[model samples]
Target: MALFTNIARIQDGLLLCSDSDEEADYTKYQNYAKQLFQKLEAMEQKIDKFSIEESEFTYHYYIANGVCYLGFFKKNYPYRAVFAYLKELEEEFRRIYNQQEIEEANRSFTFIKFESVIRNLRQKYTDDSSLADKNIQQLSENLTDVQRIITKNIKEVLERGEKLETLNLASSKLSNESKVYAIKARNFKWRMWWKTYSPLIIIAAIVFLVLFIKFFIW
Candidate 1:
């Protein structure tokens, strides 16, 4: 059985809708998904599909057209099935909402009404054993490419301590002036090294040329 599923905007990690996983104490997994949102937001190029493996569960997420569909499922659950579910959810979401609606929304879970659809789809894929088997087969025969998608350990990913765009966004803030200054300082150091040593290098080259001409040519 699935634990949780949600849809969010990749641009800013806004919660558009989340499935209701009743009676499941999946707050920890939900937090992982939220962290991924923040991590994915500043990425210039996002992963189209990926999974994070945890102890008891694995998180599957897919991105398309600036939207992200994420799900947390049992560790034994088929990755192909999970990705297929996400793709279907993404398609249905696109059918109901356009890019403008997704972008212009100000509040979290603005499309709470869409939660029903999410729950229905999750049930359709998870509850029925036969359907899940068939879907996994279809995914294997098609271009799901779940095998090639990147999968990272959740603990290692969290321990990496946000070495992301803008150089460790978590160490300070989003627009961390420190990193910017660090880059500038590096560039300046290289320029100063050249400025100071360039004269010595030129003099050495001239002396070598003169010595060579005096000895060999003259």
Candidate 2:
């Protein structure tokens, strides 16, 4: 079980950089995380802090100085510890990298070197023993109340992006099925036309033949 699933830097409603836990299944969680990130971006103007709850995990995020820091943790994990870890990450990131460098980056995971820091911090926080440590307890006490932070469920977080993907997929499937149905309908119509008109044409041909025999052959 990975404690921290992802870390990202977002600015001006765009994801500037990101890193993910390699040991975990990236495919399974990336969409969920991405959806949450988008939600954070949408809500950034209204609120600077919040948590998004999913079935198996929770996304905690903090935005400051035009940079957003996000983290993913299991639902049972301590909320204070999660935020504390993120705060530490933000401070370290600011200390090491300047704002201009982050803003100018044009690609995902532009600060790929930061993954090493993320891994080290994840190990320290994931350990059960750290929860009982006096320093951690003090840190939790000093942290802000978890209730004060805005909370949104997974459906609400995914309401836009994930829903759009699902809708697009359904639409594509319907389009293909509609094409098939159209072909079937056209074939059915052709069959009906042949059934209704073929016998009349045969009778007409026979009548023409009889007329020719009487008028010319006789």
Candidate 3:
């Protein structure tokens, strides 16, 4: 929750600062930054949805695809990699939160995680300093692709974040409308039932009167 809040604050702050500033680069950077935070916010929402909070101290987050449980991480997992991936997932989530987004990120976060894994691989390569140029080239190419995506999608993602905000509002309105309609329908049904059964009740009374007259008057 705090994580989500922090991301939201950062997102809002970047937007506010961007609005106040006059510099183009700074504005663009702020836009990207806001987009980044929006992505994080979206990721938090997804985690909350598919996740089951295991009491106040822990939570089990299910991955979107395969519905695989990520296991219960204690309230605060210290692995930077985990947080980073979550953060990246949020980024991806912001870009696409629809079914398409969810499906894509189900696979996309793998690449995001792969970014870290490849970084570790590169480090290992440097440590021994004996890895071939071919492997290096492959890793470099993959990394380039990842960066290109992040760069291009920051704006695309910010747009998605905006859509999420709109969606939330629309969802709230639709829910309220449904509730009101339900109440009206229930009231209408109650009235109709009364109207239909009231005649039967009157007929029963008239039949009872006729039976009493036949027995007593004759």
lDDT tens digits, residues 91-196, model 1? Answer: 8999999999998988998999998888788776654434335544443354332234233567567678543342221211211322332243345556667888
**Residue-wise C-alpha lDDT for candidate 2, range 17-130, written one tens digit per residue:** 465666676555567666555544444455545566667787666666767777777765555556556666777778888988877877766787887877776675554324
Indicate whether candidate 1 or candidate 3 has the larger TM-score: 1
The alpha-carbon deviation from the true structure for residue 14 of candidate 2, after best TM-score superposition, in angstroms, is 4.3
Q: What lDDT does the true structure give each of the candidates?
A: 0.67, 0.57, 0.33
In model 3, which regions exceed 4 Å deviation?
1-163, 171-177, 209-218
TM-score, one value per model: 0.64, 0.59, 0.23
Rank order (by TM-score, best first): 1, 2, 3
Q: What tens-digit string does per-residue lDDT give for candidate 3 at 26-122? A: 3343334444443434443433222222223222222333222122233432222222333334444344334443334322133232233333422
RMSD for all candidates, in order, please: 20.9, 25.2, 24.8
Clashing pairs in 3: 39-90
Backbone N/Cα/C clashes per model: 0, 0, 1
Worst 10 residues of 2 by lDDT: 163-172
Q: Which candidate comes out best when scored by TM-score?
A: 1
